[model samples]
Target: MPTARWRKSSYSGGQGGECVEVANVAAVIAVRDSKDPAGPKVTLTASGWCDLARRIKSGEHDLI
Candidate 1:
């Protein structure tokens, strides 16, 4: 959909890791597994992406 810039997660390594690539489409964020670039993708709203990002930055999902 249009010219979206898909990028791999910063946490993704150069040696091929289990990471997801993200693309910002019009009003949605698209995510796909880096290992499977041609696989299915999930889309999220702006708010959803923001919430996920915040949670990730906070330690919400960090069980350590």
Candidate 2:
């Protein structure tokens, strides 16, 4: 894959604790910990990324 251009999540707090970074790479969305720029990362298909975002917005994974 080519070098990815990462951007910080808009939901990230200015204080910057537990932040996430994302990049668009071809047909996938690349994700990584903001604190670990050089660490292992995850890649998800565009559809999968959209599904995850929708679920998150709907609170599907919220702790009871």
Candidate 3:
């Protein structure tokens, strides 16, 4: 597979937090930890990624 073009989350500034990076790799969406580029990653389908994004935006999985 070709190398993914990663895009870092804007919310991840210089401050310390769970930094995330996302990329579009062919038919799948690739996700990884910005702090651990060489570590394990997760790949999800386009529909699955959209569902997850929708859930997150609607606060359906927010923990406080």
Candidate 4:
């Protein structure tokens, strides 16, 4: 497979705490930790990605 061109979130700070990188891998959205490029990844379909984004914006998964 070709290498994914990952991009970090614009909201991420330079100090890097916890950050994720996303890439478009054909029919799916690929996500990985920016601190661990060679680590595990999470893949989601287009619709699934949209749903997750919507839920996040709605604070459904807020930690506080």
Candidate 5:
């Protein structure tokens, strides 16, 4: 497989704080810490990615 082209969110701060990078790897969506490129990564299927995004947008994972 070709090297994944990771991209950070436009909303990410430039201060190098909490942030993540995402990439499209074949049939999966790859995610990793932006501060730790060589560290572990999470891979999710297309459908799973969509669900996760929806949940996030709906504040299902929010801590109040």
Candidate 6:
């Protein structure tokens, strides 16, 4: 079972349809939707989260 805490993204500004919930689970990062807290989620490795953070910071990925 996954025991992760989730919340709105800082970038969301409290409004966004594509908003996601993030959790710092042990050795992994779990992501889910704020709208559906009890819904399915995806787990990523620490390195994966780091890479994603890098990309987002560098504006490598197109965001809405």
- Winner by TM-score: 4
Off by over 4 Å in 5: none
Residues 1-64, candidate 6: write the lDDT tens digits.
2456666766885456578878887778888877787889888899998999799889999776
User: What is the per-residue lDDT of model 2 for residues 1-64, given as tens digits with 9 covering 90 to 100?
Assistant: 3489998877799876688888999889999888878888899999999998899889998888
Q: Over the stretch 1-64, how does candidate 3's per-residue lDDT look in tens digits? A: 2478988777777763478888999999998887888888899999999999999889999997
2 against 6, candidate with superior lDDT: 2
Better of 5 and 6 by lDDT: 5
Model 2 lDDT-worst window of ten: 1-10
- Where's the lowest-lDDT run of ten residues in candidate 4? 1-10
Flag regions of model 6 displaced more than 4 Å.
15-18
* Model 5 / residue 24 / CA error / Å: 0.2
Winner on TM-score (2 vs 6):
2
- Taken over the whole model, the C-alpha lDDT of each candidate is 0.84, 0.87, 0.85, 0.89, 0.89, 0.79
Candidate 6: worst 10 consecutive residues by lDDT? Answer: 1-10
> Across residues 5-30, which tens digit of lDDT does each residue of candidate 4 receive?
99888899887758988899999999
Record all residue pairs in model 4 with backbone atoms less than 3 Å apart, i.e. clashing: none
Where is the poorest 10-residue window by lDDT in model 5? 1-10
Error of 1 at 24 (Å): 0.8
Candidates arranged by TM-score, highest first: 4, 5, 2, 3, 1, 6
Between 2 and 3, whose lDDT is larger? Answer: 2
Q: Write the per-residue lDDT of candidate 1 for residues 1-64, one digit (tens) a residue.
A: 4477888866677775678889998889998887887788899999999999899889898878
Clashing pairs in 2: none
**Least accurate stretch of 10 residues (summed lDDT) in model 3?**
9-18
TM-scores, one per candidate? 0.77, 0.83, 0.82, 0.90, 0.88, 0.71
